[model samples]
Target chain A: MKLRSQTRVILPYLGILAVYALLMAVGVPWLVRRGQLAAAETGAGFNPTSLVIYVVVISVVGLFAGLYVNLRADARQRHALNQLTQATRDLGEGRFKELEIPEDVGPLPETQALKGALESTAREIQYRMEAILKEQSMLSAVLSQMTDGLLIADDNGRVLLLNKMAEKLFMISQEKALGRSVVEVMRHHALVELWEKFRGGESKSITLEMGVNRNFLQVVGIRLDDEIPGRSMLLFQDLTQTHRLEIVRRDFISNISHELRTPMASLKALSETLLDGALEDPPAARRFVVRMDTEVDNLSQLVNELLELSRIESGRTNFDFQRVFPCGLMAKACERMTLQAERMGLSVGQECPDNLPQIFADPARISQVFINLIHNAIKFTPAGGKIQLSAWQDGGFVVFRVADTGVGIAQKDVSRIFERFYKADRARAGGGTGLGLSICKHMVEAHGGKIWAESEEGNGANFFFTIPVAST
Target chain B: MARLTLDRELRLVQDEILILGSLVEQAILNAVDALRRRDIAAAMEVQHNDRRINNKRFAIENRILILLATQSPMAHDLRLLAGMLEVITELERIGDYAKGIAKVCVRLAEEDTLIPIREITTMADKAISMLHRALDAFIAEDEAAARQIPLEDDEVDELYNLVYHKLIQTMINDPQAIDHANQILWVIHNLERTADRVTNICERIVFIHTGELMEMDSEDDESEDEDENLDTA
Candidate 1:
């Protein structure tokens, strides 16, 4: 207040000083010119009445001149001080609004320099702060929306921020997680390891298997220099599905190539043998020829079967389905297997009820499956063994059971019994490009049916199939 | 200009043929592996693949409908598309044949002594060859190859008969052969019929290519099925 008031008082004093200086320059000179006259006029002073009057006038003139000079000096100092005060006010007010000052408060060179500095500094600071704020918010938004989890903690083991993904992965909310202790939300030992690195001011990555299928995710922990003593950022990303699919694709290629190679080799070898002088000996030649023919046939079957399967998988097979009676289907299966059953002396008994409902099925295909099962039953059964085909309605399905008092399937082999090319025993094997039950199961399932088998080693085996009932 | 007909249905039908062809090829390989290695796994795989074939059938059917509705294809294009759908049916049957052979492998694998492995393998090979020829003829529209396939079916028929004869002789020599060998023979027969059907399809191919039907009576030509039963000759 003193500075401001003193500065204000000096401004008007400077105005008075200016006027006094002008008077001094012009009137003083004039007075000097008139000095000889004035001295002559005013020199008459200091006699008691006449002398007292003369002394009073001379002293009064001197006092007025001294006051004017003091006012002029005060005004000059106030002008300098006002410039400083106004410049400070402009700087504080952020003077981008206008770069001008009042005319009465005329700017000095010093005030002009201060105003330029304040505007330039304000602009630089504004640009830098805006850029930094924009980048921070963009990072925050991206982290929050990411699918992978993110965790950032301060040096004191306190949660700083958790994005939405991180919250979902931990099954916690941002509000509940923020400022909470890291140990509270991160219970995994791996995360603890990660957090330990944060404490040690080190960067590391760790993988954890903790998803639906023990899926692995790598968590990378980075120490932030700006964070408090114990802070780090952890990012978790998944890599399981990609890994498994790569293996599956690899296996598929290898398996197909190996499968294709076998038949080709067989064909080449057999044909070479047949061509190599088997013709010289009639009997030997016939056998060689037959073997060669077999190899060729094998190759063709392999190719055809592959085509068939790919076709079915690709949804190119047109199936003709009809509502056919299970009994009739079983009867056809019985007839189909009758000769084999008789040859084996296995008594084949079919117990398909006459009143059994017609099943929505493909008759030819179903009959084919039954024939396959019955054939298998006969093949496994010993002489005089019983092979029975029984069909009955049960719980929205028509069940067909083929049982044989023959060599039963091993429990371990039962699951793969319907797989194509799967042969549990090659020892006393019969002739087959083993694909029957595999095709049967698919055909049955295509009709919305199910097929399975029950068997014990050294006992009997039974194949059961059910066609799902469809209401008319 | 040859004036190629805009047979859109033919395009979809071709897809079905390719799909079915691939499936049958898989089935044949699986069936053969099942036979040679007595592989239950391969058998199950072939069976599983049949579902894909079935699904392909339906998809092809839908595409065919679209083709028929949009293209209004006539004559050859119509025949080819319709034939492709039929071929899928046959390919599915072939898949069943492979399945039957696999099932036999599953069962007879346990037997102490059954039919000769080489013989069954030979029959499967012949049938598969017939299928290959049929597919080739279908794809290339090769009438001569298609017409010639039925003669090859005779060779498969001979093998089928041989399996029957060998099994029967063993059964006659010892009644114990009845149970296992008989079923093996039946499964073998199913595979043999698969070859027969392949020849039948080959004939269809010939008919398609030549625009004339020429059915081969290979079954009658060889007379192997009944002849094997009456081996008095």
Candidate 2:
């Protein structure tokens, strides 16, 4: 190819030189003859040696001119070829800069076309490279930002890629987890079993619950054959909160049924006794009526407590916010429970620094919380035991405590005491409605506060609640 | 080429060990949970799952034996397979303890006696936590963590003692409750033994790292002996 192109370039120069040579061959001798004729007419001699010298000098001059022009054209063509070679090298090495065709190359039309072709190829490659880079970054961004944990593993179960959420869910770092088997990384039998099943082609996708109780996760594994062959993708959705809510909901329904059924059974048995000739005995009938009245009263109390709890939980109960002094609130609660405490032979006391920060709370709801707590204390404590109410300031809130020298809650029941209808087995026997603490929890939280209890069985119990200090 | 096959086989064995470890862990957790909830059905399920744990252990043992016969791994790989053999045995024994607790749960369901379940649950928690960490140390080949984890066994022992005394007190207070109290005591005994087995697993971890077999509790025993000597003095 190179030889052929060089011949093409040289052929045009050769044609121009041949045409000039033919003109010289014909015209030079004729010019010499005319000189001879002119010399004879003027009675002078014409020399043949002079004619040969003249022909040789004119031919040498014409040949030199042709050689000079050909060399200059060849230099221009070589410069254009060098530029095209450099442009191709840069394109191969991924330097996508524009090809600079020199002005001297304007006469070489073939070289110009080659440079144009090189520039277009470089442009096409640059466009594709940019698009690929953009798509790669977009994929990584989406993977990192996803809420569900995403993991990609190869056919051999070695982890290939995992996003931030997946790393967090598995409590592993990407640097350490990559290229490790999924079974070794995850360490959950159920998950590994699912992976094995997916690998065996038993199922394309599988979902299973892994981890116990509070750390529950719903893991979904899918065979990923579209984007990358023989890889699996796992999506971990943490369901701990959902599981807890499900438990609470189930407990609520069961407890409500039990509470309703107990009183209804008693009412049914009492009416059945009345119908079986117990009404004919006047004094016995009066006793039965009083017992029926008490059962109905108990039922109504249960109903009212359930209604109140649901209302507060649903945020329908409007709290009338007030900046009440902490001591005043404690005193009012103690005063309300004083009569019952005295009847039970328990002494009620309130200890609060008068200078404590006032709390933002619904006065009535806050008082109800305090009264319910004290009532629980009076019920649980021995006849001579003391119930104390105290308050103090803790960062951004005023903390209130109701402590009692009573039979304390068991360790397991301490955390659950504030749950709706959750009664300690011991508390079940010595109970008002079990809704007191649950109501207290909701009311305190409605005031933008927190509530919790501390207890150990056979020792004493302390219930603490916090209300945000009224903004100055 | 043979070395590549050996490495792959070793990874497979490791995966099986982890699977077995998790099975034992879940069994322990479910058994104790069933006891606490008095769910006889869940207890029976845990009892049935013990066979699965046993099969897993045997399967791992068979794989280790095959690797030993075919690959004849040397030095560190040999120690790893040996340590894994010991670990799977210890894990299977722990699984049995879980089954024992499940049986106790079933027994308690038939009686009305109040068991001190809170202390028992705490003991199970401590033991299972120790076991979980020990397995992690084994997987990481961390000699430091393997050595440090056995110290927590003392906490489990202390809980065991607390429950033992509490059950004795229950028996002294009510003679008719002796059978139930003895059963509850057996549950704590199983838990204390589970923690001891976790210490054994930790020992194997250290062995895999340094090829030394020694009791992890020897230091605690020496400290106890000094305490006893001081008391006598």
Candidate 3:
């Protein structure tokens, strides 16, 4: 491509032609001036008039030979140029596999170096392109096959790229997702916050509670190589299980400590008192001993319940599941909780349609679930409040429900009523560890059933649990 | 030597893991005590005993890895090991944390009242206890308790945050107490990290086996301030 290098090759050929032309001009004249050199040779063969004519003829022949050599040099230059042009055209057409630059085109040293450099450049370019293709396919596969939701959005919150998982998670087709704002589709407040953080080119993760479900979105914002200033990607991962356990573990620790702390401290205090000779004072000793006994019983009960609840949750407990009449379980549950209901001056009543199909369940666990529900109703309901227990056959399942007329659960507390240690009134003391509803939930679930509650602050509350009917 | 397979020995493995988990938890408490008492000897004890913690971790880690390789374990086993990894990480962190506290102790060198370690000690104690209960739930496979651990961490956070502001106040009140106060703050920082770690352990437990997640950020939230704000508003 360089002009100077091209001139070096062309100049030599031009010089050779010039030298031939000079020989034809000056050398022929000298021979003619001599009037004898080639004339003598011609005269030897013929007369003086004939000799002059022969001399002229010899000079003409020499001139033709020089012209022929110059023509030959010009033809070779043309051939090289044509070859170069064809090779360049082929290279342009992307025939990368066979770019053969003719070695003879480099008549000069510099031109030879240029030819080698061009060949090496083409080879390197081919190698790099092949590598890029490989990388592109790998990236495409990864983007398509990944299970976790991936979203790459621009600085203005426009969704630029989304994977299959992302599409499924947002419930949108790819065409609908791209170029749309995240908020328009997801409408999740936490997601919006996450996007803003990402748009700022900051790496962060957010845990969001969507409706009743929990999820984790780990957004990794990297300033992309594009026009968008705050463009980044957000990866959505499902950490709901992990998140729930974390809450549970924390509550368990606090409850256990708070649970154990009271009794442990009491035990410690009682022992110290005994050590300080409180045992000598019979009345004080009696009270202290009685107190110690109560703490011991409470601790034992706590441990035992912890064990039982865990077994029920893990499906490790041997549940002799069977087809049981829902009315029977409800009756027994009320009978068990009757004394407590009476103490609270609340009536426990059941409603059931006769000839109800038998529901498959663990009888004891079902009874336990009902007892827990009624017990809670009795505890929270005011004296002289009414509690109704009912069952109905619906769609191959039996629905058991407890409805209470009392200080109803607040709208906020209603959602978390089933959570472990989720006491509506933490201030109200001397109740269980608040694991009752949680245990009831797990027990029901272990039987392949489900439970839920409905409540309003002023109006009374209703708790519903369902067990599927066993095939006859 | 008897060949111990994971599936056949799951219950036993779980019990052992819980025990080791509790010991590391107790170590976290001990480290907090080291700083609170300003006892170099106790700090040295925590630093020295950290090897024991690591040894326990390696044992658990080896078991988990072997189980994964040999047992062809399906869901629950997978979750248990995965949970164990998190628990081990928390334990390792607590051990490193103990060493960090020891380093602080050696630096402080018998200074009395140069720091405010009381609130931090309270927070760490709470965190340590939380770890124990989380482990207990794991052993019992008590989903309810497991789900509640994160809820408790929020309370720990509140306490640590309280200590955080108090330390800043102390430093402002007396510039001379700044160095000692910072050390106290560091311990509190470690305690808070420990609490967060315990929450991770809790999540692992539930994921191993349990119910669906119903809420987010149940990390020991007192809602004390929120309730007051609502009342005022």
Candidate topping lDDT = 2
DockQ of each: 0.01, 0.47, 0.01
lDDT of 1 at A281: 81
The count of residue-pair clashes in candidate 3 stands at 29
Candidate 2: stretches off by over 4 Å: A1-118, A202-207, A212-214, A226-228, A322-336, A349-361, A389-401, A427-430, A449-459, A464-472, B109-184, B220-233
Q: Model 3, residue B199: what's the lDDT?
A: 74
For candidate 2, write residues A1-472 as lDDT tens digits. Answer: 5567667667766876787688677867787888789888987877567667766876787677778878888787787788778777877877665645344453555776777777688778889989998999999999999888888899989999999988887778999899989987888888888888877765544444443333667777788787778998888887778887987788778878988888899899999999999999999999999999999999898889889998998999988897889898889878988999999999888889978987888889999999889988887888899998999998999999999999999777898899777778643444467898999999988888999999988887999999999999
What lDDT is reached at residue B56 by model 1? 69
- In the range B5-105, model 3's lDDT, one tens digit per residue, is 66445654564465465456555666666665566888788778778778877887887788778777677777777777767777776666666767777
lDDT of 3 by residue, A231-270 (tens): 6777777666777788679767877788778789989999
Question: lDDT tens digits, residues B18-136, model 1?
Answer: 54665665576566667666667777776677677677677877777776676776677767666666677777767766666666667766556545667776776677667765776
| Model 3 CA lDDT for position A318 | 90
Error of 1 at B91 (Å): 58
Stretches of candidate 3 off by over 4 Å are A1-128, A135-248, A267-291, B1-233
Give the winner by lDDT: 1 or 2.
2
